[model samples]
Target: MAPTSETLTAERILEATEEVLRRHGPAKATVVDVARALGVSHGSVYRHFRTKAALREAVTKRWLDRTSEALSGIVAEDRDPEGRLRDWLRTLFEAKRRKAGDDPELFATYTVLTDENGTAVGEHLADLTAQLTRIVRAGAEAGSFETTDPEATARAVFHATGRFHDPCHAREWERPGVEEEFTAVVDLLVRGLRGR
Candidate 1:
C-alpha cells in the first residue's frame, strides 16, 4: 500500500530510515533508500528532514533516546538513592548489552551513525550525565553519599562504569564473569560514594 501524505510523518520516515540503515548499514543507507522503502518521493522525506545529515542525526537521537527514556524512570523513583543509582546503572548496562547482543548489525549501523552525528552523540552523553547527576545529587542530599560535586562525581561514576555501558566494550559484555565484574564495580562505586 502506498503511504499517503497524511500518513507520511517524520516518525515514519525515521522508522524507514532505521530499516534502510539496518539493511544497508550507515555507509550505503541514503535518503533515497528511505523514500523508496516508504514508496514516497525523496522530496517527501526531505520535506520532513531538511538534509540527509539531519535525517541521520534524528534517527541517531531517536535510538539514543530509548536508553535515556528507560533510565529516566529509575531517576524518578522515590526510593533509596543508592538503590536507585544501582538500578539505573544496571539498567543502562543491560540496555546496552541487549542492543549489542540482540541485533548486532543494527547496533553496528547505529555505532557508525553515532560517529557521523557527533552533535547528537554529544547531546546523548550530556543527557545521560544529567540523569546521573540527578541520581548522585539525590544520594548526597539523602545523606547516602558524601559527594560535594555531584556533577563531577556523576561523570566519574559514568566513566568508571564505562566498560559495562560503552559500546566500544560491547564485545566484552558477553565474556564470562562480566556481570560479576559489573556488580563488583557498582559495589565499589556505591561504597566509595558512601565515604567508606
Candidate 2:
C-alpha cells in the first residue's frame, strides 16, 4: 500500500532536516532551514511540529525507533540468556554508532548529559537501563547469567558501553581499532555475566 500524503510530507521534512543537520549541525538546523529545503512555508513545518524542540525530539525518537526495529527481530530470535545479553550490548553499540552518524541529538547524549530543560540525563539512561535489566534478570533466573545484582550490573554495563557508543567519545578514538576495542569490552561484559 502507498503512504498517505501526510506521511510522505512528514518523511520529506525529516529527510530535509537530516540533510540540514548533517550540513549545519544540530544547533544551526533551524525550522526555517527545513522549511526552505522543502520549499514549504515555515508555518507548514509548524503545523506538523509546534516547536523546533518538538521537531528535534521527533527526529531523535524516530532515530531510536529505527534502531530498535533493526534489532528487535534479532533479539527475538535468540534465547540463550548469556548470548542474548551479549547480543543486546553488541546491537546497542552498533545502533548507537549508526544513530550518532545519522542523528545529531543522539551524539549529544554524552556531551550534554541533561535534558533540554536541565534535568540529569540519568533519567533517560535509567529508562533504557530498566528495560535492559529486565532482560538480564530473566537471564540470571534461567542460569544463563550469574549476577548477584542484575539491575546494578545492567546499569553499570550500560554506562560503560555508552562511553564508547556516544559520538563525542567515539570521535576521540575514531580509528580502525576502535570497533575492536569496543567489541572486546562487550565480550568481557558478556563473559562476566556468564560467571566465566
Candidate 3:
C-alpha cells in the first residue's frame, strides 16, 4: 500500500527542506522555498513544523544523528581506548572531508562547539562531552590514560581536534595528506594521555 497523506507530506517537506538548504543554505532557506519544492502551500509546511526554528533544529539533529552513528560504530568495535579514540577521531576527520561540498550553513548550525558558554547551544555539546568524558574516565581507570581530570581533558581534546580538522585551515587546504595528518595528531594526543 502507498504511504498515508501525512507520511507522504512529511517526507516531501523534509526532502524539500534539504534541497533548499543545499541550494540557498540554512539561514536563507524559508518555508516558502520548501513549500514550492513540495508543490504545497506554506501553511502545509507549517502544519508539519510549527516554526522555522523547530524545522532547523530537526535538520541539525538529523545531521548529528548521522555523525553520532559514525562515531558509535568506531567505538563499538574497538575495545581498546587508544584505538577507539583514534578511530573516532579519524572518522570525524573523514566525515569532514566527505562533507567538503556540503551546505556550510547546515554544517555551522549542527556544530556542538559553539555552546561554550553553558547556553542552550552548549546543551548538546555538554552531553557529547559527558559521553566522551565517560570513555576517558574508563580509559584512565584501565591504565590506558594518566589523567585525574578526564572531563577537562576530554573537553580540551575535543576543542583541539576541532582546530586540527578546521575546514578553512591553511594546512587543511593544502593537499591530500590532511586526513593522515589529522589521524596522526589524534594518535599523538592519545599517546600523550597515556603518559608513557
Return the top candidate by lDDT. 1
Query: Best to worst by lDDT, what's the order?
Result: 1, 2, 3
| Per-residue alpha-carbon lDDT of candidate 2 for residues 1-196, written as tens digits (9 for 90 to 100) | 5533355476677777767776766666799998888777889888888898777766655554565565555546547666666677778777767656665553564233224522333444555676678778878888888889989988878877876755457564446887788888888887877786
What is the descending TM-score order?
1, 3, 2
Task: Compare the candidates by TM-score and give the number of the best one.
Answer: 1
Could you tell me how far off, in angstroms, the CA of residue 144 lies in candidate 3 after the best superposition?
1.2
Worst ten-residue run, lDDT, model 2? 110-119
Q: Please provide, for model 3 over 93-139, each residue's C-alpha lDDT reduced to its tens digit, 9 standing for 90 to 100.
A: 66665655354555553443233223433554565566567678878
TM-score for candidate 3, please give it: 0.76
- List the pairs of residues colliding in candidate 3: 115-122
Cα misplacement distance, residue 188 of candidate 1 (Å): 0.6
TM-score to native of every candidate shown: 0.97, 0.72, 0.76
Give the lDDT of residue 192 in candidate 1: 96
Q: How close is candidate 1 to the true structure, as a TM-score?
A: 0.97
Writing each residue's lDDT as its tens digit, candidate 1 over 116-163 gives 888998999999999999999999999999999999999999999999
Better by TM-score, candidate 2 or 1? 1
**Predictions in order: lDDT:** 0.94, 0.68, 0.67
